[model samples]
Target: MTEQDVREVLNGRRAQAARNDGAILDAARTVFLAEPDAPIGAVARAAGVGISALYRRYPSKEALLATLCLDGLRQFVTIAESAREVPDPWEAFVEFLRGIVDADVHSLTVHLAGRFTPTPEHRDLAVRAGALAAEILHRAQQAGVVRNDVEITDLPMIYEQLAAIRLGDATRLRELRRRYLDVHLAGLRTAATSYGAMTGSAPTRAEAGARWNRTT
Candidate 1:
């Protein structure tokens, strides 16, 4: 083939590969979030890609799960960072919470945590995300907008609780989560406007980490 023709073919192949990768990751998120125990074949079917093609990109199901969780962590970090830029402290906190809930990254934490071993990259991202989240929380608390009783550690459980609400219809499920999230957010306001003092201790960092640590 001519050099120009060869170059065109190579470029086409690269574009196709990028598209396939995007499809596979999107499918994995939808399939795994809907059914955490789903087999790799399900993801392949959902992605409209061959099983061999999926395996070529992700050698094992564990690897794919890790990739999905890593993506979720990246999204978490992005949301928190964006919220930190909001001028209003309370708005920043609300934006962070709402963005997280809408992103539904917590669903991965709830359904897929411990399914795959975390890598060093995962730990680093998790630390960054935690720090950003803490900064948002502390800023709101200092502004006397958020209740002081709420701890940074309380957020994981709160998100997980919202993530646990499920329905066959994604739209309905999301609306329900938002409804409950609104109620939860109201309760998270300053004590004068809150229901009462937050009861029970927040989950410790170690306790929260236990969820992500591979059991095996």
Candidate 2:
């Protein structure tokens, strides 16, 4: 290769190392959110980086707060992806709703979202996901299955509420989950069920394997 190309490659590696800063921040979210009182050294260890490196990147605890705000946008993509339909559009919305409600399992993700001022890139990703959800919600509304009043943005807000409830008390979490499902099932329109047979079956391991590339 030309000397210029070699220099470019060397510079790219340096740039990559600088960009790696965000990964450590992401890891920091997992620790800080789980235990806000945890020390910086602990967060550094949790992130698998040296304490000096962590301090060098984030001089103070307060600096990390901004990154947490950006995480909400990232978390919602998983919500949107889960909401997407495979064989049928309606079932996709239901699954998407379920994914959001079940986000109790992703506490770190939720913590990142507690404050929402996502970076521009993250915000754009969120906008794309929201558009997809709006289409699905609109279709469901047209079919008279989903609540007509439920706006697209409401999905994220509602999911946050459910996450809050889910995280609050272990004793109530199970009952709350069951009751939530029961309410969802009760609200289903008779016509919503008509498409059930058309949709056929849940994704199996083989079908999942075939569809893996398509899904990502």
- Top TM-score: which candidate number? 1
Query: The CA-based lDDT of model 2 is what?
Result: 0.59
Worst 10 residues of 1 by lDDT: 191-200
Question: Across residues 17-53, which tens digit of lDDT does each residue of candidate 1 receive?
Answer: 9999999999999899888889999999999999999
* TM-score, per-candidate, Cα-based: 0.94, 0.55
lDDT of each structure? 0.92, 0.59
- For each predicted model, how many residue pairs clash, with residues at least 3 apart or on different chains? 0, 1
Name the regions of candidate 2 deviating beyond 4 angstroms: 1-27, 35-39, 55-72, 103-117, 166-216
Looking at model 2, report the run of 10 residues with the lowest lDDT sum: 207-216
Residue-level error in angstroms, candidate 2, position 104 = 4.6
Model 2 quality (TM-score): 0.55
